[model samples]
Target: MAGDAYEVLLTSTARKDLDKRLRKSPAKKDKVAKAVKRMREFGPTYPSFNTHQEKRTSRADDPTYISYVEHNTHGAWRMYWKYAQDKIVVLYIGPHP
Candidate 1:
């Protein structure tokens, strides 16, 4: 893995969200882990089925520019994030919003 490809950071809420999801379906850990790996290696252009940036109006009041990666093949699992320089901070990980 290229440590410098993208520095992956996870927010506390995102970590909790992933934990909750993992608790519900432990079998998905591999998929989630692979998704994170691909995301880090390829960033927002990870070739997922649907990847997009959230519009300001949809973000409520949060000022950080965020994007989403549709990681699930047949479900709504998504990875919400933002990129600046080489940082890729994950803001959320759960159902599509």
Candidate 2:
């Protein structure tokens, strides 16, 4: 749907985390990008992932209420994020933290 789209942004910590992680494993970049695209096109759900594939976080516990995305080859990598007014602010990257 037209209104469900969102733009994704990374926080400073998330940016640093991504850079560090990607530096070690550049191949995972495409998977990360796909997750971002899903977030943008679907606003966290339109890809209709199972709970294992995506979930929610909240500002009370974390900086997100909606979530990041995907499983990883090396480990459980993810993005914690929240959305408002067409923006998905990625609060963190890598692991469940």
Candidate 3:
């Protein structure tokens, strides 16, 4: 548990997508912000609080996975991330499709 904390960051594409969403809906923006904050504070372990899965890996070198978190007033939202050392790179975020 000592190394549970990780640095959370969004990919450039994810940042652009989030910016677009923030301009369209304030409520949705708030929910996403909260989720992002949780990710930073709790790191990869935060996903355990929601429904999550470790995606199948073809390469042992890659540990990419995804999680479904409850979005405020809406259905579950999906987020993809991969851990590298002490960092959690958030690759994507969007409504389940």
Candidate 4:
């Protein structure tokens, strides 16, 4: 399941970030655990299947970006993916806030 189009890639730094936060506060740990569990149950579902355009000035001249709004049990998460060659690539995951 984790090997398909959706790959949960947590680097060492990201893992450290998660561990530090979870260790520092119990609330954060609970919230993150719940979010993770929700993710496991439901891969990712968008509130709307519609596509939206975004302007990313940080990327320089090529600032045009298209994104989708996905939701989970906790809240909504923005999914930046590219639909090419009949494959969907999930870029990242995090709370909307």
Leading candidate by lDDT = 1
Candidate 3 RMSD to the correct structure: 4.2
Task: Output the better candidate (2/4) by lDDT.
Answer: 2
> Estimated TM-score per prediction?
0.72, 0.66, 0.69, 0.41
Model 2 per-residue lDDT tens digits across residues 27-91: 76886777767776766665433222233433453344534355433466676665555677876
- Candidate 4: which stretches are off by over 4 Å? 1-7, 46-97
Predictions: Cα RMSD each: 3.5, 4.5, 4.2, 6.5
Clashes in model 3: which pairs?
none
**Sequence-dependent TM-score of model 3:** 0.69
Show the colliding residue pairs in model 2: 57-64, 57-65, 68-79
Shift of residue 68 alpha carbon in model 2, Å: 5.8
Q: By summed lDDT, which 10 consecutive residues of candidate 3 come out lowest?
A: 51-60
Error of 1 at 42 (Å): 1.8
Cα-lDDT of candidate 4: 0.42
lDDT of 1 by residue, 1-97 (tens): 5574677888899899899988997877776787788777766666562566577554554434444334435665677776655687888776665
Mind sharing the TM-score for model 2?
Answer: 0.66
Model 1 residue 37 distance off true place after TM-score fit, in angstroms: 0.4
